[model samples]
Target: MDWQTTKKDFKRYLEFERNLSGNSVHAYLNDVRKLEVYCEDLNLEIEKLTAQHIQHFLLWINEFALSPFTQARLLSGLKTFFNFLQIEYDLTANPCELIETPRLTRKMPSVLNIEEIDSLINAIDLSKPEGMRNKAIIEVLYGCGLRVSELINLKISNLFLDVEFIKVEGKGNKERLIPVGQQAIKYLKIYMDDIRVHQSIKSGKEDFVFLNRRGSPLSRVMVFIIVKDLAQKIGLQKEISPHTFRHSFASHLVEGGADLRAVQDMLGHESITTTEIYTHIDKDYLQSVITQFHPRS
Candidate 1:
């Protein structure tokens, strides 16, 4: 079958069968398209592709200096695509079956210390009309360890502020309740009651907790830009984004002796392995723990 036809089928399978999010489906398609381009230059047919052609494509992409993590993801996407073909078309063999994924080095996520977090939040210009809204955004992001998408899509109906908890829809449309700190709840109330109540909210957007000046919910890009601007305003050297607040929240919780399972549930991580990255504590803290808690020390 042709590349376009096969890709259309793959998209359907991803959306309906696998139930992947739109962003995930887009990423997988983009990965396949890269290989499709490579094959097109060589006059290779999608159905007739062999393991050797896949290996050559990997080598060619390596010349572009793609990171191992990206390379591994590309290979994974291809493997999934070929597996789908095998099931649908009854292909005798899967070309990606024997292929080896590139070994990836796990990089530690960047985290902000409490002081840095305070500085970044304090740098917000409270004189501006959106100042309390921005402050509440940061507080929710850090205090609740919410993803940017979750923070943007947060709804008024989901907030249980009376009991200090919030229900956020996470990846795969799963919902989780995260405990909100008093500080976050305080700013959220100020934003909702004082600032947001006075604004003319757009129809169908009144339920959203955070909104732009135009009465629309904030976009993910806007959240990233806000975080970037705040970082620059505070002269923070660490390259960070909205996700950095999440990392800081998890790191601080781990450092403060919070249970890993509790952190995992709060962060809405699917696996404990995904949440284990926060266990990489600094050596100074490790030494202090041993000195204080170990009998031999």
Candidate 2:
């Protein structure tokens, strides 16, 4: 198949079969474009591309100093593309099968301490019309460790604050119930009663929990900007955003001796291994504890 036609089919497969959103579909397509560029540089047609070609392209990307995260995503896209080809076009062989994805090192996420979180939250001016809704946004982001996409798509119908749980549709359209903290429920109630109740919500966004100034749904970028502005207002030196709160939420739970499996369920992590990355053990703290308590000493 020609690159253009194959790409078009890939889009349909991603949307219909994979059920990915527009942005996610575009991201996968962008990864394919990288392969197309590599093929062009080598003067090879799309059909002539082999597993070895894909491997070389990956090596070239690493040689060009692409970050491991980006490399990993591109590799994932390639794998998906080849899988689709095998299923649809009777192309039995997959190129990405033997391509080893780069190992991603888990870095500890930047998190605000309790005092810093309070300062950031208090910095929001409640005098504005969107103030109450913004308050709810941050409260839920930190309180539930929700992804930005999940936060924006949160529906009023899904909130079960009385039971301390909220239903979230995460990656691969998988639904999971996450516990909602009490403080978040308090802010949510206030926002729903005061600001969200009075707004003349647009037709399509009526069920959406967080609304823009025009009574519509808030975009993911808008949420990022809100977090950034709050960080600046509080003079937080560490770079912070909405997801930082989530990382902090998971990290804090792990650090406080919460059960790893329970934390995994709360964070909606697909695997226990993924949740294990959030367990940040301090070497120096361990040494101090041992020095103070060991009977041998």
Candidate 3:
């Protein structure tokens, strides 16, 4: 198959069959582009690619000083491509079978302390029209541990506020019901009753929970900007994003002794191991828990 045509088919497979997010699809395509460039430089077509060519391409990317994590990530995309070609297109042989991914170290995610969380939340200007909505946005971000995309796409119909839970549509279009904290529910109600009810919502966006001044749904970038502005208002020095609140939510829950499997379900993680990355407990807290609870102590 030709390079462009094969790549197009691969993208369709990722979108339709795999149900990967747009960003994920783009990343895989970017990896394929790198391989394409390498082959073009050697006057070799996609059909002519061999295991040696794939190895040399890996070497070329390694020379750029990319970290092991990035290399492994890129190799994952390549593996997906070759697998698709083999299974779907009935390609003869897959060169990626023998290729090995680099070992990756599990790095801890940055989380905000309770004091910092309150400070950031309190920093929001409550007098503005979008004030209540932004406050609710932060609350929901932390409360439900939602991704930015999930937050933006949140629907009013999915909210089960009466039952104290909200149905979250997460990655891969998976839906899970997450318990909402009282504070999140409170601000969300205020935003809905006071601001959202008064605004003339855009036709298609009427279902979205959070909306902008124009009554259209908030974008992912707007959510990032909201988080950044709040952090700056509180003079928080640590680098953080919307996802930081999600990490903080998971970390706080784990620290409070929430069940691992429960947290995994709330976060909509495909694996419990994915949820484990958010856990970061301090030594003092552990010692205190042991000292208070142990009979010998």
lDDT of each: 0.93, 0.86, 0.89
Q: Tens digit of lDDT per residue, candidate 1, span 90-154? A: 76777888999988777889989999999999999999999999999999999999999999999
What stretches of model 1 exceed 4 Å from their correct place?
282-297
| Distance from true location, Cα of 80 in model 3, Å | 0.8
Q: Estimate each model's TM-score.
A: 0.91, 0.86, 0.91
Candidate order, TM-score descending: 3, 1, 2
Please, what are the lDDT tens digits per residue for candidate 2 over residues 135-181? 88888998898999999999989999889999988876878899999
Alpha-carbon RMSD of each model: 2.9, 3.2, 3.1
Clash-forming residue pairs, model 1: none
Sequence-dependent TM-score of model 1: 0.91
Q: How many backbone clashes does candidate 2 have?
A: 0
With a 3 Å backbone cut-off (N, CA, C), the pairs that clash in candidate 2 are: none
Model 1 lDDT vs. the true structure?
Answer: 0.93
Q: What is the model-wide C-alpha lDDT for candidate 2?
A: 0.86
